[model samples]
Target chain A: MAGIGDRISGTFFLVLGLTMYLFVNPNYIESVNGGNISPNTFPNILSIIIAVCGTMLLFKPTTQQAPDLRSVAITSMYVLLLVVGLYAMSKFGFEYVAPVLAFVIMIAIGERRLHWLLLGIVGMPVLIWLLVTIVLGRALP
Target chain B: MVELDTILAGFADAFTLYNLSFVLFGVVLGQFVGAVPGIGPIMAMAIAIPFTFGLDTLPAIAFLVGVNKGGLVGGAVPAILMNTPGTPDAAATALDGYPLAKQGKPLKATKMALFSSITGDTVSDIVLITVSAPLAILALKMGPIEIVALMIFAFSVLAGLIGNSLIKGIIAAALGLLVACVGQDPEHFTPRLIFGHWDLFNGLPLPSVAIGMLAISEMLRRMSMAHGNKVSSAIINLDTGNPNDQRVTWSEYWSCRFTLIRGATIGTILGALPGIGSTAAAFMSYAMAKGTSKEPASFGKGNIQGIAASESANSAVVGANLIPLLTLGIPGSVGAALIISAFMIHGLQPGPLLFTNQGQLVYGLFGAMLMANFINLWVGQIGLRFWVKVVSAPESIIFSSAILLCIVGVSMATSGIFGVAIMLIFAAIGYVMSSFGYSLVIFIIAFFLGPRFEKSISQSLALTNGDLAQILKSPVAVALLILSVISFVWFMRKNNQVNKADA
Candidate 1:
């Protein structure tokens, strides 16, 4: 199980390193000033190190404590939910999206009690609003 | 040497009502999260950093220090009462603590842990106060080549010493350097890898990256562990109803004085070095205590000194880790790294120059640290019962609220929605890295030190006029580089031996 994940991460980093070195380095990192040390020198060295390490890991992966696939999937779901929820908050004012976000995440996390639901949905966001706006004098998105 | 008036003024600044109250709040919050499973001080510190933007520097830093100190004390509670340790550093505390709790002496175990924790932390802080200024003055003598070599040593030790695989650790650090290169290069101020996004023109916000990776990823991991029917939180009954188990008498406390001293010594020595964190200190102290004890068989079977050894060592690390951060601007752990950013946020640099430039403020931070130890002692006495109760907050609600807090914190710390988006992305990256057993702490440390490392490299290059062989001109640089190579080989050999034994 651990080897599988290690191998995958190795492949992932190898691809990432190659992309950064070949594509990102050429296009994104422009040489505005040429000095003794080029602007891209550090990153290029980093990318090569990453690629070499990734290659080493790919060939001879060691044992590690990898999380189960179910756990990873659950966390990924939470991440997607969070990304979508924050995007919704930006689209519709935080006042509207926040409560729903709170309510759904609460349900997803297995909160079934009514009072806790009401408080999590309505009370928590209001408290945050008060703290951010009224107390700190900052606006929430 | 610091002036008497400067020290006196720092005492005055730290003793204010405002500073005291904030420190108390920080301690209370620290204890709360420390007792609660699935959350730790780094997570708390990450979320709190953005909130402290409006506060004065001393109070803000003092509060975070309080949290870190209080966390060590509070971590021992869950380790004692339940078999589950609240923080990784507290795992060794459970060996003796749980047995003592099971023997109907929960109060005695907790009180002993709290007392020894405060004692060890105080001892470490006193050393920090006495030695830090001199250390900082000494650090001022190092040239750019030496600093660069020292940074290399830090990287080698951190990547080689931490985590299961040195390769994975280095990969994480390399990725951190890559991400750190996203903003404009320090030399030319020309953008390197912004991908045409102007928000990243100022670089990825530290709060977004730190909070997302440290706090949100941990929360997500905890949420994943919230199994069916286990999501509500563990409820352990602490009512043994024995009067003899309610307190630690002076004799009981004084009996383990030597053990506390030894633990504090081990912790302070290791904590000052980068990459050797409190968990290692705690376990090392526990092993040595058991080995040297007169009654070695009583170690895991309710020996009081075992608790003292583990708790004191872990707690002492909170103060001792700051020695490197304050003197050399190198963070030994994630907590110290966060404090460095807090200092940077407050327009205070943490290197040796801070001693010469902000003498009074530095002393004030010292004063606040000492005051927090006293406050932590007082609060731990009163809040032990409260912290035990705080651990019962449902994981579902706790993790959800943590996610919300991370979003809000990053948003407020940076621009509103854009920062939140970056945080979510990093949170995902953090989660994946976490799943694959990479050390996110190493990544953050490398990311935090990346700019300075790059600057040192650039400086070294310019000084030697791109002649890399000129590095040998400085004996100090050569010595540090040799140490780096020696440590890397030593760690790799040790790891191989351990792996072979396990296999």
Candidate 2:
């Protein structure tokens, strides 16, 4: 799992760098500053570093001394599922999705009491809504 | 002479009912988070950032500055009471402090720590206010080249001397510099590394990155460590048969008066140097005291003087770290970095312009720090017993709570999905490194400084039309470069001496 994670993250950095170098053309530079260093210099620098570091990590990877496989797997799955739920709920409308997703995550993490889950599901969202809607006066998306 | 007019003006602004209340409010909240082991001032400030959004600028920052000050003192309480340190900086305090407690001198040790911390912090604040005026004047004369050199110096020192191993520290710093490179180049708006993801356009939000790297990873480490320990390790040793065992007499405190004063000065100077945090300051002071003390043998065994030096130095760092943040717009430590983010949220910037343009907020923040010390003294004493309880909370319960808070905190900072992804990735990396005794400090500091270094270098290059000689034209730049060389040599020599002494 550790090797796989490093591989994926490395690959992500590699492709990300390649795409950045390819897409941000000089013409775009004219819009920002009439052809100075391509606006892509900074990000390209980072991308290359990430790619290089990622590749090195993948090849001569540091020895793995992480936690037990069970915790890593369980935690990763839980986090991944939470992200998926967040997106799915946002598609259904963020207000409804946000509270529901939060509640479900709390419960899934082993909160036995419904009241505690309710705080996660209802209280947080409501408070956020109030702050956003009333305090900041920005409507909830 | 310290200008009374600026300070008086500051007091006027800070004395307002709203700001005063905020100062008290922030101190209490800051200490609450600081009392929890594995949650440091950096994480505390990051979590508090969002809450300052709608507040008036002065009050918002007043609250944050208060928190920043309170956190340093708050971290020491647990170190003295239990062997556990609430923050990495306080770990040095625990080395001698806990031993002192075991020897039935908890009160004296606690009182010494408090008094030394407050005194160190007070003197540092005076130094901060005085030194800031001159630094701000000097900062005005700097260009991109000088600033770039300074950042390089800062980055080098942080990576060079922080943690146990220099190699690991350098790696961590490199990682941070790399992270700073994310997003579009500020020089040109062409999106560089977003990879077509809109979310990546602004790069990673710093608060989320910090929370994930520092807080989430911390949670994982805590939980994993707990699994190995038996459940019974949770009970408190409430054997405070000597809560009053050895009161920190006026004479004892006075005896170590010079050490306390020297430690405070060292902490202030270190804190003023960017990227050197309170941990280094505390350890440096402890070493200084031990080396200079006639009874050096008592260092590890529970010396009140050791506790005094460590706690005082670390606490003094709180005020001194703000010098760079306020004068140069560069943070000196992780907590100061987070505090800068809060300032941005409040529509304030900490630079030369801050003194001239937002003088009120700048001085107001200084005033808040003074008030925070007083509040921290009162609140910390009252809250010590409760914090002692928290240190003994069941591992199962504490770990669970930490995990939950980590999840919520990270998610909230990023507003949902993508941020958590970044955090989990780093958590894995951090966990792997920690198990090998590799320093995460390098990665974290590197990630934080990467962009700054890049920006300064690129900006300087642009300004000088790629002329490298431009870097040497500025006296400050040349001086900083020289300092960097000196620091490198000094650190290497020190490392060699230690290794030889061990041999």
Candidate 3:
């Protein structure tokens, strides 16, 4: 399973590197005295290196230590759910969704008490707002 | 005369109210983060990086230096109380610390750790101040070729230091460099590898990368272990109900004084060297102490002396690592990188010329390093009990909070949705790597050197007109290259031997 994960990730990088080379061609600002190297040169070099490295990973595969699959699946699901909540809240405003999301995560992670969840669920956004608006004075989307 | 005056000026700058405040705050916060399990000094440094954008460089650095010193002491809190070490460096502390706690003497063990940490760190800081400038001066005389060679030496050393599997370590490092390439090229000012996103223009933000690779990945790993077992919270006897409990005696301190000193010395030397980290120093020192000790069995079983040796040595490295960073521009550790960032932000360049040109900044940084040890000693002593409680917070709660904080921290930096996406992707990758027993050290350090390596190689090639021999022309470059080769070969041989034995 772990080997498959590495192979999949490695192959994805190879494909991504190819795509980056194909799609991204940054136009550089040319100078009067001497035209410098374009922005694309570095990335193109990077793409080739990445692709090569990824392909090499395919051949000389190291044995991967197995993970506790159930735990990983649960945690990943929780993270996925949270990410979805964040994206959904982006529509209704983060102020509305962030606190609830934090609360759900806390509960999911074993905060069994309802009072603690309610307090955290409500208190977290207010705290974040105070930190951003009153202290740092940065606008949070 | 100028050197003497420079030292005086540094002291003057460091003694100021603002610098003192920054140092104090950094120390306090560092200790807080350190005491918490799974959050090391590097993570604290990463999280603090974004906040420094608002401050002047000197104060910004003073804070980070304090944190570095304080982090060494902070990890000992959990190691002593809960048997769960906050940082890898504190793993040695756990050997003796948990036994002490089990014996109903956690407070004494904790206090001994505090005292030894202070003593070792103070001594190392003094030594660092004496030696760092001369080394930096030597480094500054070297040309671009030597610099590139030095960087390669550092990278190779870092890779070798990580774990048993050399190729796996290299792969992780390569992955880091790849991620680092996501940002715009510094030399040409052209965006590289940013797939139609303006956010990628700046590259994967360092803090986001850090929070993901170190903080979030750790949280996930911890959560996996924690879900299977109930977090055993046996309230150990802190008050020492038994009056006969063996408190840390003056005689014990005197006997272990040499061990503490030796450990500190080892830590200081290791910390000064790039890639050899505090954890390595701690283990090396612990082994040395045990090897030389008359009572070797006393170690790994509630020996206050063992705790003292490990804690002090590891803590001392915090001060020693800064020696190279301040005097020379080269970062000796992740913590030093934060200080370097602070310097860059404040419009001060680190190196031999920095000491000559920005004498006050050098002096100020040095002074802050010294003062932070005292601050850590004072602050850590007072906050001992509170820190223990903080350390023993349920692993589940801790991991959850870490994940939440990582998400929030990343979001805070971008202010948009992009960083969140980046965090998830990196977190998944990090989790996958962790599952495979792959070390993230390579990834983190590779990410650190990526831009510099690219710039140095290109610039060196430009100067030599693509003559690769330029790397070997300079004696310094040649020496560093040889050292890298020797180290790389040694690591590969060792890895093969270990694998054969395992098989």
Q: Top DockQ: which candidate number? A: 1
Candidate 3 docking classification: acceptable
Clashing pairs in 3: B10-B363, B10-B364, B183-B203
Angstrom error at residue B90, model 3: 1.3
TM-score of each: 0.97, 0.80, 0.89
**Where does candidate 1 stray beyond 4 Å?**
B227-239
Give the chain A TM-score for each candidate.
0.91, 0.57, 0.70
Question: Model 1, B1-503: lDDT tens per residue?
Answer: 67889888987898899998988999988888888777878888999999899898989999999888888888888899887788899999999999998888888898999998988899899999999999998899987889999988998899987888888888999999889988889788788899889899878889999998999888877776673433555566667676778889899989998999999999988899999999999999999999999999999998999999998899889889999998999999999999998998888878888888888888888888898899888999998888877777677666766777777778888968999898888888998898887999899999888888898888999999989999999999999999989988887787677656655
Question: Could you give the candidate ranking by DockQ, starting with the highest?
Answer: 1, 3, 2
> Model 2 over residues A52-104: C-alpha lDDT tens digits?
65555455433233446676665565456545754564466456766656655
Model 1, CA-based lDDT:
0.86
lDDT by candidate, in order shown:
0.86, 0.68, 0.73
Per-residue lDDT tens digits of candidate 2, residues B116-162? 88888888998987789778877877787887787768766875666
Worst 10 residues of 3 chain B by lDDT: B396-405
Candidate 3 regions with alpha-carbon error over 4 angstroms:
A1-63, A114-119, B1-3, B227-234, B242-247, B341-353, B396-404
User: Candidate 3, residues B1-503: lDDT per residue as tens digits?
Assistant: 12777788789999998899999999898888889877777778766665665677788888887877788789888888878788888999889988988888887788788888888888888887788777777767877777778777876777777765665666676677767877677676665667667778878876667667766776766665565454555355567676435356788778789889998899888888876888888888888888888889988988877887788788888878777666656677767765665565466666667867887777788799888888888898788877877765555455544554555556666666678777777777887876765667667767766777778676777788777876666888899899989988998788667756654
lDDT of 2: 0.68
Q: Considering only N, C-alpha and C atoms within 3 Å, which residue pairs clash in candidate 1?
A: none
